[model samples]
Target: MENPKKDSKKINDLEQNYKNQENTTLTTNQGVKINDTNNSLKAGERGSTLLEDFLLREKITSFDHERIPERIVHARGSAAHGVFELYESIEQYSKAGIFTDVNRKTPVFVRFSTVAGSKGSTDLARDVRGFAVKFYTEEGTWDLVGNNMPIFFIQDAMKFPDLVHSVKPEPNKEIPQAASAHDTFYDFVSRTTETLHNQIWLMSDRAIPRSFRMMEGFGIHTFRLINDKGESHFVKFHWKPKLGVHSVTWDEAVKISGADSDFHRRDLWDAIEAGHYPEWELGIQIVPQEDEFKFDFDLLDPTKLIPEEMVPVKIIGKMTLNRNPENFFAETEQVAFLPGHIVPGIDFTNDPLLQGRLFSYRDTQLSRLGGPNFHQIPINRPIAPANNNQRDGMMQMDIVKGQTAYFPNSLGGGCPHLAKIAEGAFDSYEERIDAKKIRTRSESFNDHFSQPALFYRSLSQYEQEHVAEAYTFELGKCMHSEIQERMLWLIAQIDEDLANKVAKGLGLEVPKSIEQPINQAIGADADIQKQQPPKKKIYLDKAPTLSQANTKFDSIATRQVAVLVAKGFSMKNFKKMTDVLEQEGAVIKLIAPHGGKVICDENMEHKVDAAIMTTESVLFDALYIPGGKKAVESLKKESKFIKFINETFKHCKAIAVDNEGEDLINESFVKDYKDDKAVFINKTPEDFVKAMAKHRNWDRRTIVKNIPV
Candidate 1:
């Protein structure tokens, strides 16, 4: 499965088109290599630029129009090139080439984004993350446009615009660019009961992922897989990260935003560039069409997720992102993902949101990508050669060669003939539809609180506390008292205790009853009260899988371990820890008092990765202080070094110290309870590695909660 990109003709095509300017002369857009790139053509040495200078015009013109229209949503994004390899062919499930052909390496481009943010928004925003993947399979591109969470905020596509509007910055002020805490968002969530499931996830730790590599991805909709036998099965796709799901605390998240707004983006890019590529195991939850009605929650509802306990996830394949995009704008920015771009075996369901997305995505590309010829963009182009009579308009990069452009024409000897089922032509599944069109909510889509309640209940006590605190913080940000009150009443439906905590924070009571319409979204003839979310019913008491506590903690691969060092550092202590950690795929960066090189105890010089003032503790997963009498003495003089360790301790990150390093820790907040599980004092590197693998020592959180950095 390795070097999957090397075998992919599409990836090869991109590599062929990719240009490198290293050691080459600078050039204009017209490819005339220039020796005077710095000095634009001018009338005189210091005169104004001359309009007669074609080189200046060409360079400035390209720079002026370099910016294209950004996406309306999921605007802030980072992407990578990857390949998907199947472990076992699921011929019974899907007949798609990527699924059935075990030897085939499917090229893919993955884009991770924040939903509420604009193009310039911070990556650490508390909002939904878009995890969209475009697979260049033999048939065509299959774009699995999804989010980190399995469920979404709204179920109906018609309400999507409203959801985005409310969650986005306020209309008049445009305040709070990338955040969800505001009057409009709270107002919408208070009434739109369907949003509770995903909004709860937003309030939880999942929203603030430690790294993009650690976040789980999901295809929220219930898509279908039609096999060669013409049997259709309902399918849900899941990407379980190899590094495991993990997140930073809200306090850390805020600090990280200030310290490094591009934390996740940088992490993802650095990981790939360092050869510690991100990988995720593909899992599928397949339910037969006959068993669709068996679930308590509607399978077709975009707001609900099928508990993995009900139908176990089958690990099918693995997707490894190995390459960083050569050009951000050309590859990552211009990559358009459409939910409608599916394969022969894969088909859509009647999920209203998915249905609307099918039309909306293509329509969006017309404006965002500058026209209907978006597919001609190299990133969007498929490995499979496109042979069709469809002509293009704007940005028409392709030149279709044919006298007879019309289909079924004899003049061109039946050129561009239609493909048959055997020739791998796409044919829609023969799904029987025998119902009149009606615009109304399904009775099955009404249970909004059960899954949300289930999600809350499945969390560990500490996770639940975080959720409660999140609710309090978000609601406390709202300006309108009525909006906060409505949200309190809504939260009460999910958990009375959580509601009580949030209400207490706002100095408001959790009212027993708020209004007639718990859900204000009702039809013209429907009863306002009747349209309210149905009383939650517990089908399964606890889906332990829902909890982050249940996620993988087996390995600490690619975990960033900050090694604090100084001019007279302990080479022995440093190498001892680094050797073991690097063997486990952990990356250690030397954080010194100053930049450049620092001499060790052995008088050996080492390159400093970052200076104490340049980096923050929130940027690292763990901290290591090596033993050196002079080094520790130097660290003691610097106040920021102590604060760094203090913040790391407060954030529940693992901290390891040895020899004189113990003296440095003793001078800081680690002086108290140095015996904590995650605090390794004079312990072996193996002990620190084990502690780091656990992600964090949440049990130590209560004791260190009051630590100020």
Candidate 2:
């Protein structure tokens, strides 16, 4: 209808505009072409990161300021007030009061979060979970900011911004929120081989944890523990949950997101409110400085993890989260954590990622919480007194009264003077250094394929199947065939069978070779051979601790059991099963056909927690349906009740039924699965409790995958 010439001209102008802005070469904000944006400048290949590294500063600074008012990563979070009690003093390794004082019950504030989501994103996203703990010690504040996974995607901190930008929603549309199953993410991951180790971990069940209380936490970076004699030992911190590491299937995770977006947040708060405090034992893998190079992997490589089989974890102390925050904003939202917040007995390592994080976290807080004075907030305040000469910032909550505000002042009588080493003054470890400054990672960090291979090999049979299925789902979501093919090749490098399975699921073939080399994460002028990962190696047959199959399953504390009932239910059967469950600390919720109370066969009124239509099977850990002829008939009328039973069986969760309750199960997909080990019919209450404690009958996964529910 309009002018054809004008339309052609507009198209021509748009093409010209795009051409004007096109530049294949990567550059800084200042328009300086970068030869190497992959590595931070360091003293040597394995030495500490240098302060003069402008490239690292610019990239990290930009990433830190990218989001304001909310954290750039770990935006959606929940917090709790806790106490860390020392089981025994390890003064031989460290002098920090929290670590050495057996009697001190150090107060702590812990925050759990999902990394790739906004402040409002769903809790069940398949992403890394942040497990950050801040300990208020007598000497100073110590923060162990870590994740549920032991390793990260990249090695050097210089590439962090690029990694985040790729995994985040594409800039053009921002369509996929809090998800990594996309074209940009695969493109980056295929090129950057270092991400494969953590990438495989994401595909595992660990990404979708059952609860914050049940997942293990890792410091991710190697840190140093300083003794009173100034001896240093490389240490990796671990938090072993009392409830054992467990995860929901990808199916259950998806359904839980829809049924209850705040599932995890509510689980944590409700557990604490009901006096079922969550607990974790602090463990550390300590390696002497003399034995730093004893392993095949570099201690400073953030992308690599030391296998538990190599260095055994020594359980040290226990932490119990007994209280929830009163105000989300005043406490959970305002609390700040910094890796630099260490006491006298703790010191930093030369790990490049850790070095960069020391600067990035503080910088992020400045933009997020207004200014440097965020530490003055009540939740983040230290148990030890803080006195300093620097003053006057935005939101300066402290009032410094003095005749002089400078250090070593005669007028103030040197009131806030520094203390000596013997008087608990913090000091950096005296690790000797003699090396030329360079921009490259250690050769030890180049073996990217071995650990990922080891991880895949360590998983149980069913766990491996889940990994393959997860990869299929994620890669299938990508629009580019080239990206999918590249990822398939990388997966082959990890495990050939895994790659083949995922490839089949995607209706594609694993490429024999690709146009570009396997690793393109190196610099433009860097030696390609040096950066490329070598053929996969077998370090050990398997690391048994890496798999959840070996985790503890001794108790059923805080397990949620959904009880399906209606009017004229058997009160005797209900009380018999619930009594033992409550004694074992399991939470019992009644789901009925309606919201109001239902009268049992004994004419006793029982409160209904929710109507059957309001809750899903994914919300609870297990199911119990007591026998009652009228009640069974009522439940059979509601179609969702059949779905509820079918979905529970599909998830492999434990299900128990009494006389007439068996009739209800016969009407659903669970009828065919009645003989399942976790499915108890007229079984003893103790036997049912034992089945529930096993978490799920994972063997049933082979049959349940075909369930329509």
Candidate 3:
């Protein structure tokens, strides 16, 4: 019988081999040890005579050049390091090694960004969000570049530059820093027929996600998936938030932009650090090759979507962002995403937008990163060893030892041979292509109003009202009356009632009808009459999952709760509530009248995280006012504190009052206090805790008056 000890000994030997790799000391480029990074090298007695210091010079030079050119579109971004685990084998759908092995845990880096924003822009901008992920698999680095919206504004890649330029700040003025509420964007929307569907989404709540963790991600373009048997299937990728899709009100989002420009980044960092890891389930919507043209819209069109109602998503794996980036510049900023970066079993479709991205991403990185050898950067490098004949570009890190670096070289004995099919070399699907080069779109791609109408019809009554209000607000900002009228006409095409609502708010009459298409030659059919009438809304069966009201709010994890305190506050009650909140994973920030420290009635000194003057009610999820006799008196006199309580009540956020704190609320302008869902009475901490768990009180908006205008 074979001895079990022999197998254990072999495993031990491998472990020892891995351990034998010596750990190196942290040092500078010149091999000098780094004693203290907190303080830079300085002259004696801080005299500022450090020109001869090599350490300081090197460090300053590195810091100065740390930033590269940010993405032209998705300039503002945040990233995290995580691992993706496959729950079950998907070998039948794809030969991708990462999906074949259920036991494998692949290292992943995910970057979420706001498109059309500068590097310094606010995180709450109403724009398409970039949700790109790079998987460092053993086979290679596979990048899935996607967006929060499943569909795009244009169908072809050639029109991408035009679309981006239209949405970006106008070249001459650059007035709107990170917003799409402008004349130029509205003009583009009115002129481009294909943009209607995406414009509707942009005008909706989906554009203002509460947090990066609460948003869904989608690969906008259809792709090809291949199995081990060489069988191919058309597929679209999706990443569903485990917390469920949720969004902030437009008013809340705008206020958040002012209160905290780094709201999304802060949320992600705080959540991960506090161990409330953000998770998403990896899902795919698959369609057979034969059914590619079976849908109403062409499979190659990027502007169309195969609704979940039509083809349900099959969740296959899970990804948890358990770690934050060690350094922002090195990890988050330098990491690049290219759509062309795919491993075996994963291939691209002929979707024009995707095809263009495949070329544009790599080309942009070459210039932005300053060289073709940008992949050599530690953060961008693949975990798998790269061995190829391509060599010698700017900043080349690899040191090749062969005499010949080209293929079919006798000097190198024909080394670095092409990988075989069994060795996991990428192979494209055998799709037939026999079309003439033309600047025309398929007829099936022409009917853009149907899906937009469907989306508008799909929203709940409250959501529809919000969408109408959002359109009015955004259009009111535009100085051009014609642009607003044209947009109103477009909206009317989506829904007559929606246009009428927005027009009423704008104090302008809606146009009788938008311009009839001058050039209606679309799709293969090219019948103008066929495109005149939008399709009947088929998705009216309320998809409760599409609404933000259904999102997970049971857990208060990662929620920021502002606790009001002062000298004479009830120490026992405050401690009890604080302990329960902390245990429930809520972060408490002590806000006092003064900035520094506060002494409790029990003679305990607690430091204030932020003064009432520094933070706003909009910055936190909930507010808890602990009873202190003197504290209540001081808070009553402070208008900012009163504003905080009043604004929190108006916004429909949870507000809890204890002891004498109840008297302060009674004196405030919140008159219909008893009917407000946010205002909590009685002394029990349990009721307050339960109210806080509800996240927001939707009923408060009806009764509360004198809310922040």
Candidate 4:
């Protein structure tokens, strides 16, 4: 058995350097022992947290500014401490130690976040999710700053600020936080043809994921992986979740925001704490540099994706996030991720959006983390010894031994010299760049509709319906008729049926002509007519990999199952179902009519995880009910219990009932869902487990559309 603690020496050493207060008296920041943290030094017994109270002042003052400036985007985040291990060495593709060393366990800190939301925003927002990972590798730190989607909204770095500003809340009112369903966003999207590919995806089920563990992540740019021989391959990195891609419906997302605003953050933390650590297979599409222009779309374009059918992803390793952050601020908040943090073999490309990020991320960290010494922060520090001539800045923790802060100093015996190339010295791939110093756009990046069309065509009918519904809901939120009209026209360019469906929902006609300068995202002198998007091509028909309908449904592991019971519930049915599910690594919680404990038919007491009124169906992945006349009748009294069962049915999640549990179902919407495949009545525990592994029954998707719960 491999002991994770023994293998992760980097984390162990890092922890040793931390000021752990375990089994110690509470002390002030200046190391003086404190007595009372409960009450302040008040003038009277009931006075305010006084300014004269040094102890109280220290605590309050620290807390007043406890929060650093939250990220402008991806402010709401959930992070985990993990380790990445290679399955096999791909030394030919890249010589980075984290990629090539199969024996080494590289400690990693991964933060998952929503792109549009503020720090206090809801996790269920209909926006892009940021997937940023920091690998504290032997060579140095490497940050893979990416998103859940493979493509982005813009092609150039210059338009990034404009894109973020438009998608954010309206500048005047600051209304509708963490959402893109506004006039300004559609205004930007309607004009920029490059935004179509990612805009369509945002309208798909990928935007609002069921859990952080159940989504795929993409590098979103054409990065380079160089070998020791200095050979470069255009690579697109992928993080394929083992639990498979899954999501809640838009209706569910809206309700879940109210039900549990910390849905994703809680799900991730609970899963890891329960020993069901989430895992992802790291894969890369290694496209030869010479074959970059072989595809119809430009490789340098951030708005385009190289279809898996064209260049198959090569699975390299697996990353398991086994631990939650020890402290949210020390680890999750302060940890910085930059695209510029690369090793010898991994390098950047000319992807404009990526080039912008390489600069933006580094600059943002300096502001957010106080100074350039942010790298010295424990969470952001590299495992390897950082010996350099770069001296003191803000928050410089290291104590320099000698009077040598400059390079080429003979007094300090010319110490801290640069490492040789063989000793893992950092080096960029020497690619020749001889071009005119002119501000001109590449005509190759103009064809944007084809990949979006390809993405839409690839999804299953059920998935397609979700996309259409998402578009209808988003566009319905916009107040401007002109914005909606132009959006409808853009939708028409992607698919006529999709456009017509949205038009019908909006109660408007798809315009014959809306705007002539559709591709107006160019310089002043550029010919408007000549800059028109080229005809979209049908390349490889359908990339099935893009569809979540084709995701793996192999395991029900770590799924949240809510068990409903009250006084005198069946002990037999509860034990039989839970024993199997618990064996399969599912976390089962007992929700009763009241808090505290519930008495089973066997007179045995079981702890109640949540009362009927306290919890909602949106918080759970599935529902289980055990038989007992008293238990069923008790659960029947609460209206929320009925709503709970109805909401679960409407969401198409698996529901299992044993013996008298059918009685409870009879009182709710489950009476109408008798024939539903996922609604197993008096089914065996094994059968319920199998159904849950399928995630949800899609056949029920059409029928349960109108259930008002």
Residue-by-residue lDDT tens digits, candidate 1, 1-709: 3343245665556556665436355566667875433223323221223335565445434332323587778889999999999999999988898889989889999999998888888889888899999999989889999999999988766566667778878889888899999889988888788889999999999999988899999999999998888789999999999989999999988988999999999999999999998999999999998998887888888889999998999998999999999999999889999999999999988776776677567777877788889999999998888887878689999878768888789999998787888777788777555443334556677788999999999999989999989999998887667678888888888888999998998899998778734442344444444747547889888999999999999898999899999988999989999999999989989999999999999999899999999999999999999989999999999999999999999988899999999999988888987889999988999999999999999998788868878
Compared with the true structure, the alpha-carbon lDDT of candidate 1 equals 0.85
Summarize candidate 3's per-residue lDDT along 1-709 as a digit string, tens digits. 4332346666568779877877454467888875433222222211121234455445534432433587777889999999999988888889998988888899999999999889999999998899999999999999999999989997665456557777888989787888989888887777677788888888888999878998999999999899999998999999988877767778788889998999999999989988899999999999998898778777777888887778889999999999999999888888888998999999987675675566567777876787788888888999998988878888888898878888888888888888899888888877655444333445566686878887887787767877898899889877767778888877888899999999999999999966653323233333443434544445444445556666666777667899888777888778888888888778899998889889888888899999887888878878888887887887787778878877777777778877888878876666457556557765566677677666667655556544553
- Candidate 4 per-residue C-alpha lDDT over 1-709 given as tens digits, one digit per residue, 9 for 90 to 100: 5433345675566567665747476678998986444322322211112234565445534432323578777888999999999999999988898888999989999999999879999999999999998988899889898999999998765566668878989989997899999888988888777888999999999999999999999989989998898899999999999999998888889988998999999999988998888999999998898997788888888899988988898899999999998899999889888988988889988775676566567667766788889999999889988888878889898887888988889999999887898888978888665443333356677787898999999999988998888888888887767778988988888899999999999998999977644453344444544545536789768999999988998888988899999899889988989999999888899998889988999999888999887888888889999878898888888888889999999988999998888888898877987888888998888889988988888889878878888
Candidate 4 scores a C-alpha RMSD against the true structure in Å of 16.3
Q: Model 2 over residues 126-234: C-alpha lDDT tens digits?
A: 9999999999999989999999999999888887888899988899998699999998999899988889999999999999999999999999999999999999998
**Leading candidate by TM-score:** 2
Give the distance in Å from residue 328's predicted Cα in candidate 3 to where it truly belongs.
1.9
TM-score of each: 0.89, 0.96, 0.86, 0.89
After superposing candidate 2, which stretches have Cα over 4 Å from the reference?
1-24, 516-522, 527-531
Weakest ten-residue segment in model 1 by summed lDDT:
38-47
Local lDDT at 664 for model 4: 80
RMSD of each: 16.2, 3.5, 19.0, 16.3
Residue 377 in model 1: lDDT: 93
Pairs in steric clash, model 4: 627-660
Question: Candidates sorted by TM-score, descending order?
Answer: 2, 1, 4, 3
Task: Please tell me which model should have the higher lDDT, number 1 or number 2.
Answer: 2
Error of 3 at 370 (Å): 1.0
Question: Which candidate achieves the best lDDT against the true structure?
Answer: 2
